[model samples]
Target: MSFSAFRILAEALTGHGGWKPMWREPEPQARYDIVIIGGGGHGLATAYYLAKEHGLTNIAVVEKGWLGSGNIGRNTTIIRSNYMLPGNEPFYELSMRLWEGLEQDFNYNAMVSQRGVLNLCHSDAQRDAYVRRGNAMIMAGADAELLDTDGVRAMYPFLDFANARFPVKGGLLQRRGGTARHDAVAWGYARGADMRGVDILQNCEVTGFLIEDGQCNGVETTRGTIRAGKVASCAAGSSSRVLEKAGLRLPIESHVLQAFVSEGLKPVIDGVITFGAGHFYISQSDKGGLVFGGDIDGYNSYAQRGNLPVIEDVCEGGMALMPAIGRARLLRAWGGVMDMSMDGSPIIDRTPVNNLFINAGWCYGGFKATPASGWCYAHLLATGKPHPVAAQMRLDRFERGLAIDEKGAGPQPNLH
Candidate 1:
């Protein structure tokens, strides 16, 4: 059912009897033209674009569980396109643009809030670095502004400005960067794709890949063997495990990144805030809860849980940045597994096996890059060529000695 003011009014006047389910639940087909592994944000977006933009309707997104039951629902919901590298800036700018028109394009309210994102700088060197990043963002067609101490204070006066260890100096503000309703994005994309005849096969686990002569033809699933003309995997944290079924070992590691939210109170935070001296970042949700997170646990695993040390470190960072929140009781905490690559960048390209495409290695940028990643992955699957903006995200970048270390995190996945 189409949603609008008129619809809402009619439903209210008619005793609210005209509501409908968002999308249909379908069984897996015997075969499809394309098969996508993983029903997270990226997979759903890919299916949507394949049908909406490329007119390839015979696609299926196979998931081992319910839709939006993965990292898509467990994130802090932040979105931004602030990068200082040539290989990433343009691609993320495309994502930012798509986020601007996403609701209109999909005909669903994902609550794309561009309230703004402020990265606080604690030192002169940090401020200079933000200036460079802001310039890069502006050059890539994204909005950015450099805010001094007074400017940041005006926006967030509750911060600890005089802390000697990590005093607030200034901040880099991206007026278009903010959060969204994370699950709504997935549901909207899923509904859009379903309306276009794309089958969403939830609970259909991909047990193995059907490959012969170094060409992937289909997948072996829990339901049955579903053959396809092409196969793509956008399995997020399960990237390595899913691809390993095809005998391809990836240069990626999985780590758990925890997030927390406080009990709902009166609205306090106006926009997103990130501490420069540490890894903590926070924003207030629409329900008046303080949403926040920090660094990944210093280990590799698929478990969706973290230890106490990282929690302590995150709380310390939050208190150092904003002492007012030191006494706020955390309501709940959750973790999302991150697929971190060697150079802290994503890979979107054809693998050694023919007819197989890979879209993985998105550390912390998956939610923000959802639209652009899907557009580029659909472009590649449709035309057998990389999207111009995502041309540099090839799987062979390491062999060519061109690692896009956007965070200067080196080859260690934990460091990134």
Candidate 2:
């Protein structure tokens, strides 16, 4: 049902009992025009755009488990387009624009908040780097502002501006950057796709790909053998294992990235903030919990849990930035397996196997780039051509030395 003010009022008057399930639970079909692996944000978004933009509803989104059970529901929910690289900035800008209109487009309340994101700089060198990055963001038609120490203090008075090692010198602010309700994004996309007649198959694990003579015909699933004209893999951290069934080895590594939420407290943070000297970033949830995360575990693993050393490190960074955060008791923490590419950038392109496409290597940007990733992947699957903004995200970029290393961290997956 379409949600609106009138609908709410009607439900309120009628004892609030008219709500329905967001999406349908359909059994796997024997055949489809396309089969998309994984039912997270990217896969659901792909199915939505494929039906909405390409008029192809004969699609199946095959998920191993329940919807929104992956990284889509396990992130810090931050979103932004403040990038610097020519290969990365424009694509993220498109994502930012898509996020701006996503809730309206899907007819759901995804809570796409634009409360702004501030990246604090701790030294003169960092300030200069932020200035250059801010200039690049402006050049790419994205909003950015460089704030001095005084300016940052004006916005957040509680920050430890005089830290002994990492004193706050300035900051780079993106006024349009903020967070969203992660599960709602998945639900909205799932509902939109279902409304358009796409089959969403949950609890159906894909065992292998139905590959024959260098062409992908469909997938072999636990439920049954399904045939399709094209098969796409949007599995984030499981990309390598999923594609390996087709005899393809991806240049990707899976690492666990943990996120934490503190006990409910009075609203203290109005926007997202990141530590320049470290990877810690935080934002206050509407429920008043301080949600935050830091670097990924420095290892490869498929499990959805992390060790304690990284947790201690993240807390240290948070304490270093805002000494007051130490008093807030930790409520809970969870982990998401990140698909880190060699160059720390994502890949959304066709593979050597014909009729097979892959969208993985998102690292820490998956949740933020959900809409654009789906939009671009849908464009590629529909027309067999890379979307203009995502053309550089080809699978062969590494061999050609065209890596979009936004972090300039070389070819190390852990560092990115």
Candidate 3:
């Protein structure tokens, strides 16, 4: 269905009726039961879950910029739960379950399309790795299929099956994994939380944390100070800056990730395809646009300027898989800063401060894990204890020499 029609249908189902506020003024001196910093998907979802699930209605989500205008707004919007490590497997599986019911629960369609995701393997070792991933998925009670070269070709007829350089051998296919409308995800949660009386403060940059006796009590923002019983940081790219302002240093490197989209055409790709060897992936949107992205920019910079190498590499991967797309002209490209954790997983536990909590890292997989992240984070905030789903993502995991390094790609920040 067209996005316009989808929007109307979403409104009718949600009872939110329609879109209204583009921007809302911030209240200067509002005291809330919970204050969540950085109004991205995680923050907004946390607020929504806190109110909807736990009945913690007095909450506020403070964003430095406009709502859904941060990394949550800038991601490639792929959703999947095919994880390798034990620590990450179950949590992401929980996220996948949440994605399945989001539309019914929120009464808003985020346009979550589960066209599936195929993680391609180029060699024997890679094929074995894919098998392991598939096994993990099955063990976790998630749907996954191990495909051979013939299986790959049968599913994706346009691929160059005979290419010697990176011949298609097989892949681990997660049938439930796919994409969601990134902006709508933020708006859906925002609307849901707003309906529950949670304040969403936009354009209100947080300047510092109000800590007393080594515990956070509130926050100081550009608008004014607002006191809260608890605070959670869901800031993605600017996480380090926010933490530093609060007199803490986290092992997160801020870097930029870029994605490209080609001019629309009749849909060809039916599902998300990731070429592991090439470090790239492509998925055709419902709009017929070829949405694609690749590895990080490989440097630490807040600047969102994307380098040419990764872009060229991504396009080359596209050409290798489906040569027909080579004729498609590039329309536009954009970038967003990602706060990559040292272990390539999220940090969703209480901070050293008594009442402060954290839900950062997330790397590139934050979008898919939004619901579960929020659910677990709200549990952490409400009960003052880490939920079973997120017990492995403690802040002290790195310091305690017990990192959950899921990618097995090493401790380097940019591997994922």
Candidate 4:
């Protein structure tokens, strides 16, 4: 049932009893044209685009848990196209445009707010770097503006401008970048995919890949054997684990990235803010809570919980940026496993196993890249070629000594 104003009015007239489950909970089928592993935003989006854009509806999005159970739900919900690198800029800009019309396209309220995102600079070097990044963003067809210290202070007076250490020199602002409702994005895509005849099979964990003659044909799941013409994995932190079942070891490390939200208070932050002196970034939600996060835990593990050291470090960064943050009581926090790649960039290319595509190594940019990631992955799965914007995200880039190290931190998962 499509949601509309008339439907709401009719349901209201009928005592609001006409509502139904957003998507069907289907069991696994014997075979399908495409079987997507992991039911997070990317998988559901792949299924949705495969049906909506590629005209392939006989698809299955198999998930181990419920929708929005992974990084899609665990992120800070920030979205932007302020990337300066060519390998990453165009793809993210496409995603930013897609986010602009996502709700209208899917007929759901995902709350894609473009309140803007500001990256503060504490040093002259950082200000110069942001100037270059802003120029690059303009060249990539994304909006960006450089704000000096007075301009930033005029916008946000709560910041600690007088701090001798990490003084706010300037900031790079992307007026088009902001946060969205993370969980709603997953549900919207899932519902849209279901409406297009894609099967969303929850609780159906992939046990292994069905490989024959060096070609992947399907998957072995907890439910049963499912055959498919092709299979794709967007398992996020579990990307390596899923590929290992097929004896494919990826150059990806799994680390827990934690996020936090404070207790509700009066409106404070007008938009997203990042501290240049450290890794902390924050934004206020519509519900009055300040949502924030920082660097990933400095370790390699699959656990979804984080360590205290990281939490303490994140809080310190917050305090260094805005001393007033200490007055707000901490509400809660959670962690999502990150698939950190060697070059700190993502991969959206076919794996060594023919007929098996892989989408992994998103690092810290997964949430922001959801739409274009799915679009590109679907394009590749449907046509057996990489999308132009995502052509550089090949799995063999590292082996070929041409990694897209966005952070300039050479081959360090924890650093990125």
Pairs with steric clashes in candidate 1? none
Question: Candidate 4, residues 7-43: lDDT per residue as tens digits?
Answer: 8999999998879899998878899999999999999
Give stretches of model 3 more than 4 Å off: 1-26
Number of the predicted model whose lDDT against the real structure is largest: 2
Each prediction's number of clashing residue pairs:
0, 0, 0, 0
Taking the tens digit of each residue's C-alpha lDDT, what string does model 1 give over 1-416?
Answer: 67788998999999988888777888778889999999999999999999999999999999999998998999999999999898999999999999999999998999999989999999999999999999988998888999999999999999999998998999999999999999999999999999999999999999999998999999999989999999999999999999999999998999999999999879889799999999999999999999999999979979999988999999999999999997789999988899999999999999999999899999977899999999999999999999999999989998899999988878899998
Worst 10 residues of 3 by lDDT: 21-30
lDDT of 4: 0.93
- Runs off by more than 4 Å, candidate 1: none
lDDT for each residue of candidate 3 in 157-247, tens digit (9 for 90 to 100): 8887777788888889999999999999998888888888888998889998889999899999998999989988999888889988877
- TM-score for predicted model 1 compared with the true structure: 0.99
RMSD of each: 0.8, 0.7, 3.2, 0.9
Evaluate residue 164 in candidate 3 and report its C-alpha lDDT on the 0 to 100 scale: 77
lDDT of every predicted structure (CA atoms): 0.93, 0.95, 0.86, 0.93
User: Candidate 4 — worst ten consecutive residues by lDDT sum?
Assistant: 398-407
Q: Global lDDT for candidate 2?
A: 0.95
- Candidates' TM-scores? 0.99, 0.99, 0.94, 0.99
Ranking by lDDT: 2, 1, 4, 3
lDDT of 2 by residue, 259-329 (tens): 99999999999999999999899999999999999999989999999999999999999999999999999
